[model samples]
Target: MLEGHPWFQLEVLAASGKSAGNKYRDAANWILEEEMPEEVGNKQVEQIDSKIFENAGIKLIFSALPADVARSVEPELASSGLFVFSNASAFRMAEDVPLLIADINGDHLALVEQQQKSRPGYIVTNPNCSVIGLASGLKPLADNFGLKSVFVTTYQALSGAGYPGVPSMDIMGNIVPYIHDEEEKVEEECDKILGKFTGEAIEPLQLNVIASCARVGVRNGHLESVLVELETDATIDDIKNAFTEYKGNKDEALPTAPEQLIIVTEDESRPQPVFDSYNGSPERARGMAVTVGRLKLRGSKLRFFLLVHNTIRGASGCSIMNAELAKIRGYI
Candidate 1:
């Protein structure tokens, strides 16, 4: 995605082990079917060293580092005067750091400026994968109707665990009821994303967010069954209008910003991962939108199923969108 961006280029690739100093195409092959395109495939993979940032004129670091590694490396990269757009969990809930969902809380990116006062540069992060869908679905409703409480159950995909994700014996035909740290992350991050950012820090949204996450057998999109009770009474049509009418950050023209934030559907069985996973627009922003379906309402309470492409709207693509918004707003 970095290489394909008009303003960005895949200047350098970094890795450890034998893959280092080799072509990116020849690096780790975790997904056998998705070959690295020759365009970026030919770039040489280098060791993860600070020297490369200056030597290659790299201004941004799009990190998909594991949380344990990010806990150490990300601060160093940010201190080296490089903007780090991380998908890792480290620093996400930092009182000073911004757990940003570009469209939802672009204002939180302002936290980077304050962070830069202490560190040489800044680290801005997208939220946990599951929180992405949950937050996106909740934003419009929270904004228009005001949230009383949110009860969400996630049917997460296999790829969310990363390549070679769940072992065949444990997840091939079964549904695992829990994912380590996922539920807690969802509850905490949801409050932050839906919260109001005070100038000094975020005032977490004061609402009950009950989340239950599970790993299912699907390959891509993360599916959510959401039951929300709004503070204000509304009809099902009002909720649908809130979703389909949501236009948070699209007007900014960020490269990865989807033309529509959410797509509301009427089909009862429509949001299954296979046919409804990739629902965004303008080609460049495909899979960046959330698909909401099976919406049911009872007075102030509403229920719906939402699907988000975990890798796109949730992780890497969200990281990229944050960078684009940062660049436009001069935060980078």
Candidate 2:
């Protein structure tokens, strides 16, 4: 997405280290060292600090640090009055910090006025990857039919595990049935992402999410099998409409926003990872659309298959867009 924004001049900021190690080295090499062939640009190779913030005169900070490291660094950055847009799980559930998905809950930015007590810097963290896909598919349905319960089985991508992730042998042809803390993160983050802040606190939806996660071999997209139960009595048409024309982030003019919120496929065998994973919304909507297939509505239950680009839409891309939205809204 950095490449997509040509109108603005962006400089390379030092990529901080996570508990695991350097996550930005490879990319910085390409963007800073290699991309600029002749001119030797200034590159800082130090840890994140208030010195860098003060020297750089940075107005905003976008952090994709490891969860634990973020637990420590994020509050510090925020204390310095730097607007923080994070993709870490650190402060996602904080009543004051926004658990943002630009398409679903952009209005929640109003609560930042009250977040001063948490830290000098207000933080906006995106929801978990699995939850992002679930929430995108649920938002329109909830607005239309009042979603009550969602049961999902996620075939999460290897990239979601991060750098030097699960060994190739462990996931080559095998599907590990359980991923520690994944189900809980999905369930909780989905509720918060779809929630609204009520002056005093963020009030998450009273929706139930039951998830079963497995480590899959797919390099990018995280595919899920979801079954949603609505509170109201509705027909299959209601469900189809939710996925057919749902366009949540379109009006925002977000550079990375998808044109359609949920993509409904009639091709029975559609939304396959190899083909459909890259479609639905590949650019601004990149990782922004939830591709829904096998729509089956029987009585109160609605079943479908969904896909998401775990890292792009679910991780870095989502964080980047959240920052962009904040910038456009004058928060940074």
Candidate 3:
């Protein structure tokens, strides 16, 4: 995704792979199943260090580190003037750090300024995979009707657990009901993402979010069933129109931004990883749009099924788009 960006260039490929001293091609096999494109595979894999990034003239970074690793590495890099667009859970709930979905909450980017007052650069974060799916589905509902309560059950993809994840012996044909700390993240992060950013910090939207997360054998997309009770009366057409009409808060077009932020489908069996996972338009925007289907609205109660590409929309793509928004907003 980074290689195809019109504005950003792939500078260095940094990782903790054993092939640290070798080209990215040496570690590509261990990471992705697809053939590594020559675009970035030829870059040397280097150990992640603030000084090394500075020496390489690197100013922007896309971090997909483990939370434990990011907790230590991210601040050091940001302190040294590197914009860290992180996918890790570390610092996501910090008062100053924006748990951002740039299209949903461009206002939250204001927190980056507060962060920069203390340091040369700052970190921006995207929520856990399931939270991304659930939050995307709830944004229009909460905005138009005001959510009184949200209940979600997520059938999350195996890839959300990170590479080499979910041992085959346990997850080959079985669904793991428990994913460590996933439920809590989904329940907590949504309010913050849809929160009101007050220039200094985010005032989390006062709504009760209850979520149950289960890790399924699916490869990529996260499929969630959501039930929301709205604060006002609304018909089915009203709800559907609100969802279809949402253009999001992103003011301008972004290279990685999808043509439609949310695509509402009529097919009952849609949103499956095989068909709807890559629902976003244009080659560059693939997997970046959330696909919602099975909408059933009865008075103030609404139920729907939603899908988001866990790795793309939920992780890397989110951080990439946040950087693009930051660049347009002059925060980068």
Candidate 4:
């Protein structure tokens, strides 16, 4: 997004110590080849150490580090007055940290002020990849009809495990029914993301969420089968219109914000990875939209399937948009 934005600039690329000579190095090289300018192609990946905090030119740090590594460096970076937008699970549920989704909860950015009380720099996080899509798909419904409870079964993409993930022998023809703490992350993060941010603290929504996460062989999009119980009565048209007319972040003017934050389809077999994986508009926002299909309503219950680009909308793109929202909200 920085590459396409007019106000921001990409200045540095850093990596963890263990990434040396690994796929992380190769992936950085690939990004340089495809996105970086010729003059910046030779820029080396710096170590994620204390010295990086001393770089005055660096104001914001975007981290894709594992939870442990992020937990180690993020506090130090924040103490040194550098804003950190992380994709790790380290500080996501902290009282002051905002688990942001840019469009869905831009207002939650206010929580950073609480962090600023202790340090000049603060940490903000994007929700887990699976939670992002599910929360996004549920946001409009929660707003329009009021969600009572949600049950979801996720068919998450392999890319969510990161580069060189899921050995072929293990995942080639198999669907792993469990993914460590994925189910818990989805259930908890959703409530937080959909919560009300009081002036002093976040009030998590009381709605119950049950999730079952499975790692599928798919390469990109994460697809979920969701059943929602609404608090009020609504027709099928009401639910579909909630999605179609939903414009959570479309007006944000962020380079990475999608034209449609949520796309509702009438087709019976849609929101599929093959055709809808990269759904988004305005070139820069590709792979940033959540696609929802197979909408069905029975009494107060609503059912549908949703898809999200796990690595993009669920991770990096989420951080980028959060930063953009921060900038717009003057929290940067």
Q: What's the CA RMSD for each of the models?
A: 1.3, 3.5, 1.4, 2.3
Q: Which stretches of candidate 1 lie over 4 Å from their true place?
A: 30-35
lDDT of each: 0.87, 0.76, 0.87, 0.87
lDDT, model 2, position 263 = 76
Q: Could you tell me every candidate's TM-score relative to the true structure? A: 0.97, 0.88, 0.97, 0.94
As a whole number from 0 to 100, the lDDT of residue 199 in candidate 1 is 91
> How many collisions per candidate?
0, 4, 0, 0
Candidate 4 per-residue lDDT, tens place, 1-332, comes to: 55646766767777866543343335363521245455345556667754664663788888888899898889998998889999999999999999999989888999999999999999999999999999999999999989888999999898898878888998988999999999989889998999999887899997779999999999889999999999998998888888888888665688788988889887888989879988999788989999999988888988899999998899989999999999987888
Clashing pairs in 4: none
Clashing pairs for predicted structure model 3, backbone only: none
Summarize candidate 1's per-residue lDDT along 1-332 as a digit string, tens digits: 56468767778777665678887777867473455667787778898877888898998989988898889888988888889999999999998889988898999989887888888888898999889998999999998899898899999999899987799899877999999999899989998888888898899997778889999999999999999998888888888899988988765889888888899888878898998888888787888999999988888889999999999899988999999888899876
Query: What is the full ranking by lDDT, best candidate first?
Result: 1, 3, 4, 2
Which residue pairs show backbone clashes in model 2?
78-121, 256-284, 257-284, 258-285
Segments in model 2 whose C-alpha atoms lie over 4 Å from true places = 4-9, 16-44, 117-119, 280-284
